[model samples]
Target: MLRFFRVIAPAVLLAVTLAAVFWGLAIGGAADERTLLDPGDIVRYGLPLSRTLVNVSIAGLIGSVVMAVWALATDRDEYRIAMDLAAASAAVLTVASAATIIFTYIDVSNLAFSPDASFGAGLAQFVTEIELGQLWLWELLLGASVTVLAFAIRGRRSTLIVLIGALLTTLPLAQQGHAAGASGHSQAVNSLLVHLVGAAVWLGGLVTLVFLAKAVSRDRLALLVSRYSTLALLAFIGVAASGIVSAWLRIGSFEDLFGTGYGQLVVIKALALIVLGAFGAVQRQLLIPRIATGERGGWIFAWLVTAELAVMGIASGIAGALGRTATPVPQESAQDLVGSTPAEFLTGDPLPPELTFSSYFTEWKFDLAWGLVCFFGIAFYLAGVIRLARRGDRWHVGRTIAWLIGMLMLFYTSNGPFNAYEQYLFSVHMLGHMMYMMLIPLILVLGAPITLALRATAKRTDGSWGGREWIMWMVQTPWSKFITHPVIAAVIFVGGLWVFYFTPIFRWAMSEHLGHQWMIIHFLISGYLFSLTMIGIDPIPKRYPHPFRLVILFATMASHAFFGVTVMTGDALLLADWFGAMGRDWGADPLADQKTGGGITWGIGELPTLALALVVAVQWARSDTKEQKRKDRAADRSGEAELKAYNEMLAKQAERDAKVGPRR
Candidate 1:
């Protein structure tokens, strides 16, 4: 089956892409008027819709390539590595060529017509130029990689060089059209582009490192990973520096930063990246050395990699949103996305901000309950973190911080942004999911709480506190078992999305004063459960079998994606606000909302799938380890007993000599 997929998937993807190309060209031809593309008119052509669809297709192709690579790696082939790289190169070529071709099709007159799209042809031109240009660099590397790989594998450079040359022709041979101008973009947009590229080089390289670690020499791999760690750290620092500067430059005032749509979304993006960078820093500073030493650092490396990957995914999401907002779309006011009453939508403002702290405080007790929960939760976590780190055990601090961040993201902030956007607004919802699903899971996974709990317990040699023991007992109880089961976790994750969306809960929550709070709860539960089930970085008391766990992850993700594509293709208005009720126009169209959600799911799903498969495969390979240990126990036990007796004999002899006199 894997073999079949490897061969056919890419072929299908390439076919779809070629079809889209011809379809686009035909669409271009059918328009009677000259559709010459100028950079300014790029925005006028309603090109984001076009660009987004293309994004969907391109992402699918990349996903196919990733799956193909995985299949190649795991297949029992001696030349697995060589085959995988060749497959990857081919995938990269297909995507890059197709992206560039769209630009070639555009000419000049198309620019003048866009309403607000004049800024850079609706940001499509901007993105197309960047991705298409970036492909050339990949082409070069693909060639170099093939050359080196062929030589290493086949003991010849000639075939490799020929492959490299063939890869070169994959570059844009068609007309090099004028790339979009960035002049109209706010400084934030300009800076974001630069940050994104830097981020891609850093995070994408890290991802490749994780995937290739098994094949590379351990010593060399350690050094290579260290280099990447350094690179990631630098990129993070750049993200922080550029992000803050860009924020200040783009936002006009506090209102713009907080009150306005662009600013608030940017704030969310910036903050998520900040948390992600901090997570990466821990990996670079702490884990790399320990891992290089080849000692068992327990689950630390796994947590670090998962956190980094999650961060990378969220960052990609932020980049997507940036493309949407770097320049405003005229006639598509903020009100439209928010689903303000038609009066408000047509007038160009968000739904009146009704659910404020004041409203929550009015019903003081319930509000107080939530307030206490978040406050104490954050405080307890942070305090424990500081205590553990100070005790020279970093795990406690790491896990606590991760849990706290995840809690805050899901239980508190997810909804504020959700409400702030109004309706099932696509961009805001994406941001919300990024927070709840991606960012929160990342932090929790990094914490590796189970391992931390064990270490913290071990360090206290005295075992003085029975109080801590009770808490530990409860955590390990059967009831706790039910909650943490992979199947249950998967159910929570897969079930939560639909329950929220399909039920009136989604509507009532959207309409009522406490709806934001409800949304937060939904996000937290769904996000945490999802993380716990699939990429599970936290300690597991008893885990499901490797095969079962893998199946669980795959199944849950499939569920999520099933809904996701359904959401995208769904013409039915799932949410009342999605239809833009009368005067209250949701800022973005329902179609756009559906489309954006699908894109997020489609783009982000592949990484998790691959990660899950690898982890599960590792688990499967180790299934007999427990039995082997049991069989060896008696012999090991006797050896330890003998060693213990020898140590005692030495201690006793030393004591006797000291008491009696040195010479005797």
Candidate 2:
């Protein structure tokens, strides 16, 4: 049974996926003959089929690397087999991406195969000049790179690098297809990327586990399965959440779920997810424990896994068809821009209502990527606290409150009116930047999350990387040492502001979604590192003395205040094309608004700076008190021996001075 399952399970997955693809194509009319520029039924049907291969291959490629890094030991057969699977999957991804690129061009161009120069030139132009074509070409290149790296890389750090490359192959997919449209474009792309990666890891990890069934000992297999269950749980959460966001963006209304073909396909996919989730619960609750305890044999586990993979195949195929099906809500937002203002035309969204005090709290435009980060940040921190508490360990309540407040601030900064109005208001954007780079990090560092995590998590003995192991590795690395230094951290904190605002980076952050996200991350890290160096309770290679910390703080504060003043006093507008051309009829004028932003930068920043200074002063005072207490305790222990020695030295010094006076 194990041998049969090992050989035929993957084949089963492939056959079911293809069959489901054709079935979905039939239901959605994606394979119907086009009235104009029909590329023939072969191209119409072949495109979705090839996409299924790409998706499955991606699952295999990414999943194997995740398993190898998180669960399987490097010296074991399980780890070796997982890497081999990654290599094979990456090779498949390369060919499938190539096929997808060709099929996509044929579908788009409606041109028949030919050997003529014009045809070759058109094909080359599509791949080189067009956005969709460029994306696919990049995917192909990334896949090919992963294929080579997966075979060559074996060390833990090297495998992680290869894994990152493997994941990069999926980014192009997120930016293309229906997700490329302007309306809710960022949300759609973010949600779809989240869904793709989550499903890939969850589905691919299980398939890899099935293959490992025959290679590893039963007990070892059970242990690996247990480790994988944690990944599956996290992946499930991400997939489920992102799927809802994706569906809402496309379906628009609950009624569409029952009415539209696209919505029906979503229903089918959702059902498959439910079934797969049930399979995960069974694996975690019933099968794994029983198998580990010798109550259930490994063969039963193999059959159950095969069934799970078949279900995953159905979901994967349906998802591909959903991409091809016409969405109930129009994916393209260009038509809505017909009579829009310059603001709408440029920002791709309507100008928000006039900024008000209440709007800061009431208005919201969710950022899915950062929303997920904040959610998981608080959830995991709370979970760690709970685990520690259950074990009769004490973590400060103040720390917990500080962490929650920081995460809440993070969520609000990304999703609240600050985000909604940032494109329109330079002041609001600058305010959000202040929170991201200073206030949020100040609160978060006080939480001492690294210290909490180190205290909370158990040390892993296996040759696999877990949360605790990875954290320790990050802290102790040479790069970490260099970055966390007071001087370097101060430089980054102070210098980054000038470089960002003065460079094209400011323009990119304003106009591009990915660039905006990167801006937040870069500033947040710079702030965190700076705060960590100054007042963080977390362990580090070194920290400056308290007086020196005061000096660094004062220097950074002066530079920050100078930057704000510089912006306020400058006559020229930054990103004149963007902020100047917004055509806002409400609020301050562009130049005036830019000045307001500078004022905000200068004004709102002082509170955190003062807080940092006070904390440093308090720590210094406590350090002195502790030193005096140590000396007093030593005097008590030694019965004032040091004090008597001091007096004896003074007496000898006096006698020597008298003898010298007599001589004079």
Candidate 3:
């Protein structure tokens, strides 16, 4: 039965994918007449086909590497098989991405192929000069890079890096999916990205498992299945949530779910998802447990997975078509608005109402990515805490509260009124920055999530890896040691202010969604590292002496103040093109707003700095007290033997002096 599944799964996947693509194209009007020049039949059909291959290959590449790192033991045959699968899939991804680049260029430019220098030059100009072409070119290069890395590197650490690279290869593709200069653009892009990654992991992991069904030893097979089951569950949730967001963005209304061709395709995909979810539930609840007990469920599991893969293929096909399908509501409605403001042109939203104290809490702009992150973060942290309590282990309630507060603050900074106005108001942006980099980290570092995770998660006695093992490995690695160093963390935290604001990075973050997300992640992580170095309860590679830590804190504060003062006193506006161009009817002048931001940098930023210093001072005093008590305990245990020995030595010395006194 397992052998039959191994043979049939690929065939079924190919057949269903092709059928779904054609069916969707027919319904979505892929062949509809248009005003623009058509690139011929090759591009009309070939582009979506190539895209389907790209999605499948990316899934295989990322999923195999993830499974290798998270499930299989490093020394086992299963690990090597997974790596080989990754390499092969990466190679396919490279080819598919290259094909996608060609198809996309042809589709966008309506260009004909020619075996001549003129054609080559045109292609080069398109890739180098055009935005759409450049995105695909970057994706292609990344795919090729992953292909080589996957083939050459098989060590655990290197595989992890390769997995990250594979994941990154999907970013450019994600950005290119929907028009960026539209309302809800950020949510659409974020949702699509998450959906792609989640689907890839779920689809690719299952495919790899089917391949490994015969290769893995019986004892390890159960463990690998169990591990993959957990990953699939998480992936399922990501896919479901992201799918809903994406569908909502495109479909606009529930009635359209049946009214429009795009919506109908979405309905089909959603149905496929439900089917996949049902299969996944059974595997997680029934098959996994049975397999773990040394039951022979491999054949049954393989067949079920094969069926799921076929369904996934249909969804992938529908997804490929959805990207090309025309929606009922035009994606560029914001751009189409009459007399749009610069803010509307750039950020896809109108200039927000003037900043007010109450507006910060009431005005809300949802950032789907961070919203999901905070939701899941708080949920998981609370679950861990609950698990510990249920096991009769005491966890500090304060830590849990701190974690929840931190997550809430993160959500607010990323999704609240501050986010709504940050693009238009420099001061608001600065407020969000300070909160992200300083206040939020300060609260979160006190939570000690890693410690909670270690205590709450069950230890895997089997050779297979799990979340705890992965987290432990990450913490103990040399890279973690280097990043956690006090000097390094301090530099990243303090130096980032000058580097980010003074360079094009500020403009990039303001203008591009991906760049903005990257800025948040970088600052948050840097802040967490710096906070950990100073007053973190979590274990780290090394701890700075209290006095040195104080000095570091003071130095960092000085640097931070200097940065703020520079911005405050600057004659010119930072990213004057962005903030100056907003053309707001309310708020302070651009320079004045910038100075307000600088004041925030200097004044508001100092609050966290002072709190950290106080915490460090208290810890230093407690350390001294603890040391004194340790000495007293030693004296009590030794009964003053050292003092008695010293007295005897003094007496011996006195006798020697008395004997020698006569000669003197």
Candidate 4:
């Protein structure tokens, strides 16, 4: 069975994927020779084919590393095999990306292959100067790095870096796909990223499992399968949700589902997803447990894996083809937008309607990335709480409510009216920033997610880093200890606010999508760290006394208030080019809006700060009460032995003092 799988599984996947790619290309007219500047059929067809290989290679590399980190023990053959898979996949990715760059150059420059100085110069300029070329070149470089790093790194920590490098290689592609300035550019890019990652992990994991059949013992194999099942389930959800979003963005309307070739390909891919999802469900619910029970599950598992891979190949192939196809809704670039306004030219979207109280509730610009984060954040936290309940372990209901509320707030801040108007309104941006930095983190810290996870998750005897193990590793690390320290957290929490707004980072965050995401992450983490130091219930390496915590809070408040006051009173516009050039006709004057933002920063933070202080005071009183009760119990057990010892010591001291006085 193992030999059959090793031979048949990859062959079936490759054959089906190739067939689907060609079929999709034929339907989408992606391979049609252009009336002008035609780069020949080979360049047209070869580009998508090479990209298909790139996708498959990315899946294999990232998926194998993820499986190794999460499921397979490092000391076993399974881990070694997974890393070998990653190295091999990285090599393929590097080669395929190079081919893609060459083809892209051929298509763009409309030049035939030649080994001349002119050709070389043009090619060099293309790779060095063009955005598309630079993106692919960076991908090739990262892929090569992963290829080398994957071979040497076997430990979980180092392997994780390799995994991150592998994931980074995909970012260029995501950016490349959406850099054309699609209508919902940010959403399209984020959805594609989610799709790529989820699909890669799901498909590549199955491929890795096929190769692992002979690598581990039967009992261990069952355990690995069970672990992989969990990953597959989560990947399925991500892929499905992201697929819907991507399709909706491209197709635009229900009628286009049947009207356009791109839509048809999307439909086919969606069906493939459904089929793959069904396979995953069966594997998780039936095959895995049956195998663990020592039932006749080997053939069943092999056949199921083969079927799923074949379907995944179809989905992967169609994905590449759809990229080349024209969307039903034409991608609106700056040139395409008729009479484009300054706001549209700069932000790539039209100016929203005037800001009003009702509009604040009505306006929305959903961010798929943060939307997923919020969704999964709530889902998994609830799952942990539910798991505790099922095991008859007590969990505080207030924590659950706090966590849910926090997720809702996160969703709203990132995806609702605040996000919608932030680009145009500095006040709105500052409001969201303050919430991200103080309010949301305060509530989220109250959830004590880490503590709940540690209690709810079962400990693994194997060396694999499960949820509990990963949590422990994170909190126990020296770096984690340093960052979570009360003083360090306070500095980061307070100092980061000043550094971010006063530096070029603020401009970058405003203009670039990636920088914007990074800003959100930094604020949330900094805020969480500070909140954790003050009143967090999670176990950490260090905790200050309540009095010291109050001091830190007060100091932070003073710094924060000073920063806000400076912003409010400043005459200069921080991002004058961006905010001043927006040409918005609604709301306050640019300078006045900047002042409003500063006011928001200074004022909105007080509520959360006061809440933190109150929580700290309550905890302090509780600590004192607990200490008093403990002392009372000790005194009762000792029957006033401590008091007698104290009296005896006082008598001796008095006697010594009298003797000394007489001598004097």
Against the reference, the lDDT scores of all candidates come to 0.49, 0.88, 0.86, 0.89
Which portions of model 2 miss their true places by more than 4 Å?
A: 177-181, 333-337, 644-664
lDDT of 2 at 336: 55
User: TM per model?
Assistant: 0.37, 0.96, 0.95, 0.97
Per-residue lDDT of model 3, residues 297-368, tens digit only: 766676677778789888988988887788877877456778878888878877888888889778998877
Candidate with more favorable, higher TM-score: 3 or 4: 4
- Alpha-carbon deviation at 380 in model 2, angstroms: 0.9
Candidate 1 deviant stretches above 4 angstroms: 1-379, 389-419, 422-424, 449-470, 473-478, 533-541, 577-579, 582-587, 605-613, 616-664
* lDDT of model number 4: 0.89
The clash count of every prediction, one per candidate, is: 25, 0, 0, 0
TM-score of 4: 0.97
TM-score, prediction 2? 0.96
- Ten consecutive residues with minimal summed lDDT in candidate 2? 177-186
Error of 4 at 259 (Å): 0.6
Give the worst 10-residue stretch by lDDT in candidate 3: 291-300
Better of 1 and 4 by lDDT: 4
lDDT of 1 by residue, 393-416 (tens): 655344565677765654454324
Ranking by lDDT: 4, 2, 3, 1
- Report the backbone clash tally of model 3: 0
